[model samples]
Target: MEEFVPSAAIAHFVMKVKDVESSYAFYQGLGLRGIDKFPEMAIIELRGGTHLLLAAKDDPMAGALHASRVGQRPDFISEKIDLMIAGHTRADLEKYRAELMANGYSPADIAEAPLYGHDYFSMLDPDGHGVSVYTSHCGDKPV
Candidate 1:
């Protein structure tokens, strides 16, 4: 009998936003092409075949989805969520940072980490979720 190896990959990343439409617009401005849209939810495609699901806080499914995490704390605030995006090269990371800045997004200044062997920049989405753009070192060599 062959051992079953799980092929794991991120299919969708769901996030609760205060206003679905506004948050959708925010992501659209960042070059994420919208794949589907609904009154209380939206699906945006990222670069690496992963989809971002944005759900309105007031949506019923959103409530149920986060119910376990919230427990009895109705006022519980979600801890900072990091959405890391990878670029093909260091220049690609810098280009994304520059484009974000030019489009009025105030991303943190780019920084390099020797330990990680990559360059990265961080920014906050409309709902204050952390979004980071980076170029990885332990992957196919950059073109």
Candidate 2:
């Protein structure tokens, strides 16, 4: 069989949280474009126009789609990979980390991944979802 390829991209990432406003602010703080927000939901746009849908835990459609979902607990922190965003370079990661810190967010110090040799840092969002920002590393060599 011949190799198959498809041109597809992510359109939306749905997240349920107890406080839509808080989650919305977090994404906006990360420089993601926010397309207005209400008490129940928010639509934040990524660079590729991908929308990160932050829905209130009790949102009708969100509740219907999932049997159960939990919100963040102040005492617990999740270190799992919830989302990963790529910057143009390692310097971008450093600047972004500074911005996050200025905004009162304590992101971990940037470090290089030994396997990939790209810089990255992780922080918990308002909903306790782990988010990683990394320097972009695509393809095998220069284009």
Candidate 3:
């Protein structure tokens, strides 16, 4: 057998949301692209060139696929996933966090960690997915 070589990469991350529409709106407000084709799935494009797939719990086709094919349990959807975003400085993250708070979402517990530098706060989207806003000051490097 020969080793497989890669050409390019495409990735999709799925998170379970109790209400797809609400989550869609939430992510959309965070400057994420693509929100119209929702309810089936809410897709958010991150600043770091990644995609987020917010899957609704009440979606029938999702249930069918998971149940019939994936052999997943009825409740096998994760409530959250840590999404890493990039910014140049702590102030940059703070500006965005303020926008998030103004939109009625609490960007909680700004903290500086040993691994990552002077970053602050995280927000739970309508679906309870944690969106982390970090800057490159407190830690040696961004993880």
Output the lDDT of residue 71, model 1: 45
What's the lDDT for residue 106 in model 1? Answer: 93
Give the lowest summed-lDDT range of ten residues in model 1.
76-85
Stronger candidate by lDDT (1 vs 3): 1
Give the Å error, residue 131, model 1. Answer: 1.1
lDDT of each: 0.72, 0.71, 0.64
1-143: candidate 2 lDDT, tens digit per residue: 55443356677766777799888888888888989887688899886567887878767867653444346353543334333455567777788789889989999888645326667888888777888776666533221
User: Looking at candidate 3, what is the lDDT of residue 100?
Assistant: 74
- Which of 1 and 3 is the better model by TM-score? 1
Instruction: Sort the candidates on lDDT, descending order.
Output: 1, 2, 3
What is candidate 3's lDDT per residue for 11-48, written digit by digit as tens?
56666688877787777887778634554876777654
What TM-score does candidate 1 reach? Answer: 0.74
Model 3 scores a TM of 0.68
Instruction: Count steric clashes of candidate 1.
Output: 0
